[model samples]
Target: MTSLPPALLRPLLCTVVLSTPLLANAQEQRPGVQAGITFGATTGAYAHYDDKPLVLPALSWQGKRFFASPGSLGMNLYKADGLRLSAVATPYTLRFKTDDVNDPQLRRLHSRQMSAMVGINADYSADWGAVAASVKREVSGHGGGVESSLHYSYPIQAGRFTWVPRVGVVHSSARLLDYYYGISDEEALRSGLAAYKPGSATSPSLQIAVSTPLGTKWRATGVVANQWFGDAVEDSPMARRSSQTSAFISLMRAF
Candidate 1:
């Protein structure tokens, strides 16, 4: 072999010694971030806030099956055997404005109260499907209330693409529904509009999601969801206000 320079050999030895530990450290700390966009029918422009079809950005972190996002910024623990525990937070509103159903001269009323929520969710999952139930207590806002929901998700895969269909029902107590969607007498007069009453509401919703792997570490996803209401509740006044259905498409990536 040609004579090797001692200077080159010394650096080679150092690199070999250092790289092994660095590689081990990297493997131990499997930290990663995933960012993407999402569109939902009822959630509006801010996929998390609007009650209408909207396109919004999404980001998440997943470490050894523990996943989190800004929309679900709380901690979650899960097991493969169909058990999950989660804590999440989201923004909510109470009063909003709307056009009357043929009544003239009355402008929209506004309460304009904003708030946040902290709640827990429990779910059971399996290869065939998943059922999730949650009870969330309002942490802050004009009036406190409770929210409960039950949902199911089923998955189908073809080649590199996966399709998931979900269905769910939600029920909110009077305090919860009114607190987020009901306007008060004072707010009505102030906004130069008619005041409305508060009551309970229920929604039954369905959604479909199609996702395909973009590469070894990325994926693209699309979704469309629709929600129909029960007589107990009024739809969100701030959004497209639909007892009718809506749809949207989106793209997403994960690592």
Candidate 2:
């Protein structure tokens, strides 16, 4: 796969860094827009890849029937009795450049490019917690495949801050996993690594987020997350660890 130029890659990296969804417990979902900046870092899952630092703009909007966030956009198709249905589009962020790898052999492999995903989402909210499920397909001509996820989150009030704990599972189709992690015959020959073909995989993830108001117009949020890879991804020669850890913080002002 051809690597994206630095000009395009930078913006995409920004999207990845700012992809964290806004905690519903943190603020009221009113018709408004927020914009600011975020600073964060990540210990990515790829072999020979160093920890990455992130700085990106934070932007989001919510309305009666429409919503937009850092890397995604959606419109509510149905909403009633605490249940909602929507159509959404987001970006797949498991992308890396050959030059980003430290190992010589890994650097010889082809780069993985990002793709856009489009699909539908169903969400239900209650006093106990919130549950959401979504199914998406790669729509950017990058080895088309489907991905799906289900998640649940509960929010707690701690003093002036709202804390949210979330758990989720994500499933990736064979084609999607192979596009990002598989070592092809040509790549294996060039890098001198054994060729690998991964099947579909499902991974689990956990996350905790906290948010508070900075002032009348400013708000701050921070998050920590961990994701465990399934056998299909962990067994890849390009995998560095069975799990990945990441964190981020943001400050935004409403307009």
Per-candidate TM equals: 0.68, 0.91
Every candidate's lDDT: 0.53, 0.82
Error of 1 at 104 (Å): 9.0
Winner by TM-score: 2
Query: CA shift at 33, candidate 2, in angstroms?
Result: 0.6
Clashes of each: 8, 0
- Candidate 1: tens digits of C-alpha lDDT, residues 1-255: 675465343332222221221111111112477666554442321101323233445566666655555344556665456686877675542223232212232244433344566788787778878787878877775568887888888878788777778888888778876654555778666655445555777788776767776776666665555667655444333333445443444444546
lDDT of 2: 0.82
lDDT for residue 7 in candidate 1, whole number 0-100: 38
- Backbone clashes counted, model 2: 0
Please report how far candidate 2 places residue 139 from its true position, in Å. Answer: 0.9
* Over 4 Å off, model 1: 1-31, 38-56, 64-66, 77-80, 93-108, 187-194, 235-246
